[model samples]
Target: MNKDQQPVVLGKIGASHGVNGWMKITTYTDSVTGIFDYSPWLLNERGQWREVKVLRWRQQGKGVIASLESVDSREQAQILTNCEIGVLQESMQNLPEGDFYWRDLIGCEVTNTNGYNMGKVDQILETGSNDVLMVKANVKDAFGKRERMIPLVMEQFIKNVDLLEKQILVDWDPDF
Candidate 1:
C-alpha cells in the first residue's frame, strides 16, 4: 500500500481449519459474516499485497471460517495464515458525528494544559472499557532522547481534539 493511502485493516488470518483451504479469520468488525460483503479482500503477507476473492464464509463458534476463491488446499491456506487483510482508507465509510477511527486520531499533535508540547499520538489502546492514547513524547535525558506514553482519560487530561488542525489539547502535567 502507498504511504498516502489510509489503512483499512479488515481482518487477519488466524489458523488453518479442517483439511481444506478454509481459514479461521479474526475480523475487526462486530459481525464476521459481513466480511463477505467486501469483495476482493487485500491480504498483506511479508509486506506484499495479494488480492483474493471471498468464495464463501460461515460463522464458527467464536470466529468465522472463510474460503478464498482460488485457494483449494491446506498448503495454499497456510500461506495466508497470519496475513493481515486491509484496503485503502478511501474504501471505508465516513466517520459519523463524534466518532473517530483510530487511524484518524493517530499522528495528531498533543499538548498539555499549560500549553506544554507533549508530542504526537502514535497509537491508541482499546483497553476494554476505555481507550488510551499512546503519546510519543520526546523526552531528553543526559545521554540522548527517548519517547514516552501518556494515558488519555477524561480526568485532568485530553481536553479537546481539533480534527481540522489535527491536534489534541490535553490537561496534563509533563512530570508525571
Candidate 2:
C-alpha cells in the first residue's frame, strides 16, 4: 500500500448489540481496547468510507459492544454489521528501538552470514516461543530449498535488520 494512503483497518463491526443501536466490535490490536484509542473511526459502508465517532463503548465478557454517534436505532446499527473500522495509517503509534512492524518486514531480503542470498521474507508466523520468518528462496539454490523457516531469534539466528537497506542478516547455513 502507498505510505500516504489512509484507512488501516483496526477492527470490524459485528452484529447490532441491542435495540438501543449498540454494535459488537472485534479489534485487531495488541489489547482489545487499543482500537478505541483511535476514535472517529473510518467505517467502510457499502462502497464508501464514512467517519463515525464512538459515543460510548464497554467491554462485555470477552467481546466489546459500542454505541456510535448518529446511529441510534437497531436497524441503523445492523446496516453496519461486518463493515471494517479503520484509522489513517499515519495515525499509527510509533514503536521503540529494535521493534519492527510486520508490514515493514514483509518484503525484506534475507541473507545468510555465508553471503548466500536466501530469499525475501514471505510471511511471519507467531509460534509458541518466538516468531518465525518464512523465506521464499530462489529456485536455483544449491540446497533446492523453495522456502526456509528461519527463527527470528536475535543472536541465535537473526543477526541484523537493516530497514533502510531492506535486508536481513542471519547466522544460517545456506545448504541447510
Candidate 3:
C-alpha cells in the first residue's frame, strides 16, 4: 500500500543495540512482542514510507530488539533510530465487542448528553490510572483554550462511541 494508506504506528526504532545491525524498538502495543505479529513494517523515511522486512526479533527487558533485512551494520541500524514502524490498516487484527483501536477513536467528534459539542479527538494519552482523550476544542469553544482532556472511563464519562458517525458521546461537564 502507499504511504498515505499506511495504518497505525505500532512502534518506533530506538538506538542501535549492537554492532550486528540489531536495533532497540519501543512498541506502542500492550505487549512489545505484539508488534512482531505484524510483519513487513513500514518505516517512515524522509517523508516517505518504505517497507522493511523483520528478519528476527527478541524481547529484551521491557522493550524489544530486532534485526531488519538490508540493515547489516550498526550504522545502517542507527539510520532507523526514531523511525516509526507501521503496518497496513487492513493487516491489523480484528477486535472483539467493546474494544476499539486508538486510531479509530482519533478524529471522532465528542459531544455530551446535553448535546453540547465538546470537540474532536486530537489524540489519546495513557496515564497510570486510565487513558485520557485529548479533544481539540471546536471553533465555538476556542476562546483561548485549544484542547480539553477527557478521561476514557467507559459507562461513566464515555457514553457511546459511534465509529460510523465518527463521534463519541460523553457525559462530561461542559464548564470543566
- lDDT tens digits by residue: candidate 1, 51-104: 778888899997799888888988889988999988666567676886666777
Ranking by TM-score: 3, 1, 2
lDDT of 3 by residue, 1-176 (tens): 75358557998999999899999999999877999999679998876788899999998998889999999999999988999998888889999987899999999999999998888999999998999999999877834457889999999999999998999999987668
Give the TM-score of each candidate: 0.80, 0.79, 0.93
User: Which ten contiguous residues of candidate 1 have the minimum total lDDT?
Assistant: 140-149
lDDT of 2: 0.88
- Top candidate when judged by TM-score against the true structure: 3
lDDT of each: 0.76, 0.88, 0.90
Order of quality (lDDT): 3, 2, 1
Query: Model 3, residue 85: displacement in angstroms?
Result: 0.7
Clashing pairs in 1: none
